[model samples]
Target: MKSRAYSAHTLSALVLLASLIPLASCRTAPPARPDTAPSVAIDGSTMYCTISWGKRGAYTLSGQAEQLDGSSYSVTLERLDWFNNWQDGWTEASVPLEGKLLLSEAGGSWTASKIEKPVPARTSAAQIRHRNTILEGNQAADLFDRRLERVRATAAWLASESSFSPADGNQFFARAGKVLFPEQNGYPEGTGQSAVNAEFKAGEGMKWNRTYTEQSIPEHLREVRDSGTLWRDWEESRELFYIAYTWEK
Candidate 1:
């Protein structure tokens, strides 16, 4: 018993030390919902999601988006790419989702959570963080390109597992601007926005591979991973984080 006790103590101490190190990063704490239900500005940004401690035992997270001028902003908690679908969108009051109550509608404090979807190793957060960001004006555009790439990959992943089908890729991207990435579509496009797309890229297979896959061979996603400058050329485009969650608490 004494030996086990010492080992446990040492383990706890190691865990704490690891958390303090950037390399030992942990999941972010989702925002908290307001208890008094104050009037939160609906201009842009501001979203929420659920952070479960265990199975269905969690609270809702609510927060606002912070970003540069003229661009969009958003905030949200974790979510799931249940069907491998992704959305490059934003949520003002809660995490972004479909067939859900608006943050304003829910009112008051709620449970928080997050949606963790598998991203391609090449396009993962760590990878993008290391990418060249030398340009000024094109910095935002470059990030957008990275984001769109991830979005497309995740959506394609989702489509494979879900009834979504292949033909839905472009459709998903088109409607995603409105459904998944709502704030971008919410505003006129570029008045401060943030969006999130928490969907796994459904690997191409007869059955959905719960594991991450790579480019089938040598081909790559055209237009997204050009290894050069990328511009947001959508007829009208905006930035937003994909975050939101269901909170029954």
Candidate 2:
């Protein structure tokens, strides 16, 4: 089949978060028995239930991080409900997962959320057909992986530094944003199927720049707690300094 030309725009991103350097992390949902853990548990945070609507489904996972040297810590989750859009009667809340992999490291903790699944997009049969064609046999995988490596290196570099560090929090976020959604190669088409995406950037293009200690978390969280409406839902904008994006290209 003749390869169709695809638009060159970046949309997908890979995030390599630093596992909180804490005494411990994670809090799984209450188990049926003492030995069973229905939720995911981190230092102090907990995520319960499947990524379904407001209801805590069979699998609940959450994590908490207590700074090894301090009392104040941060908690983050990468479960189905992490979207924070969890609502009552929210159906089709998750993709049928073969199984979930609990990933924990010195950096912190993270769950697959959807496990290599693309957050479904609204596309017509015609659109799907078009995507199937143009997005195929392209070097998108290479670009995606390359992007991930860059993010990993960038994150690692940032995490290694001390106070007044070389990379600021906001700066790290900006780098992350770019890594997840590079302006160069456009979005990745598949998690996987082929290495079509890998043909573009082999060595490197933009050496990610880094800076440290910068943040706008306070103002962000305050706005969320006071939004009066989507307060709990008001998780984006800044304090959320965290995000994930998937692509089918």
Candidate 3:
């Protein structure tokens, strides 16, 4: 009976010790670390950093420099969370730091390391011109002689009370003795035409007789003429027509 009791107690002790072995191993093991530093690059105004851990996962840190100093920049980092959604992370962190930083597996939770200075990408002149063109609302120099011809033809059509034809393809037209100019790409199209129509139909005769001369030209148009690169042969008197007529009695 005594031998049996001792044997039972020993069996219980062995089981408890076996169970605690795994817990002790877990406590003694160190936390996993990344194999290498993050990769960093810059494009335009944005900076990107890529970091990876062995078998754990990989993540990217995107940042923008809000302020630039000598050899360093105050950057704002955007990181992806565990769910892989982008969110704002650190703000105004000095980058290109000298030491390692603790990065958390969860984004926006860990400290980021310093990155190398980024090189500014070169932009082409043609790209600049295209961007400017878009910003300028697509207004180009209407220096073609056909523009004046179209104006004259529209004036004739208005006098004769003829139906407009799509074949004419004239950009400018006249109705009720009011010479109309189409809006440029950047400018509101048909707005000028609508205003002229409204004025012509109000009451009876012509309300205003306006002339567009060199002195009357807008500053931008004059600049276009001076540049002579985009447009040429701007003759205000010949291109712009005078409309003088009263409503029929």
lDDT of 3: 0.25
Please give the lDDT score at residue 230 for candidate 3. Answer: 17
Model 2, position 122, has a per-residue lDDT of 19
Please tell me which predicted candidate would have the highest lDDT against the true structure: 1
Tens digits of lDDT, candidate 2, 191-233: 2222233322212323211111012112322222222212212
Report the lDDT of model 2 for residue 159: 42
Q: Taking the tens digit of each residue's C-alpha lDDT, what string does model 3 give over 1-249?
A: 001012343334323322222121111111112223333333333333323221222222334443233233344443321101012111011112222222232331223343432211111110001211211111211222233333334334443443332221123222221222221122133334343433221112222212221222234333322233212111222212221000000
TM-score (all chains, Cα) for each model: 0.23, 0.22, 0.17
List the RMSD of every prediction in angstroms: 18.5, 21.5, 30.0
Task: Give the distance in Å from residue 209's predicted Cα in candidate 3 to where it truly belongs.
Answer: 99
Report, for all candidates in order, the number of backbone clashes: 47, 57, 2
Give the 10-residue window scoring lowest on summed lDDT in candidate 2.
Answer: 10-19
TM-score of 2: 0.22
Q: Over 4 Å off in model 1, which ranges?
A: 1-39, 43-101, 110-135, 163-249
Better of 1 and 3 by lDDT: 1
After superposing candidate 3, which stretches have Cα over 4 Å from the reference? 1-35, 46-57, 81-249
Worst 10-residue stretch by lDDT in candidate 1? 209-218
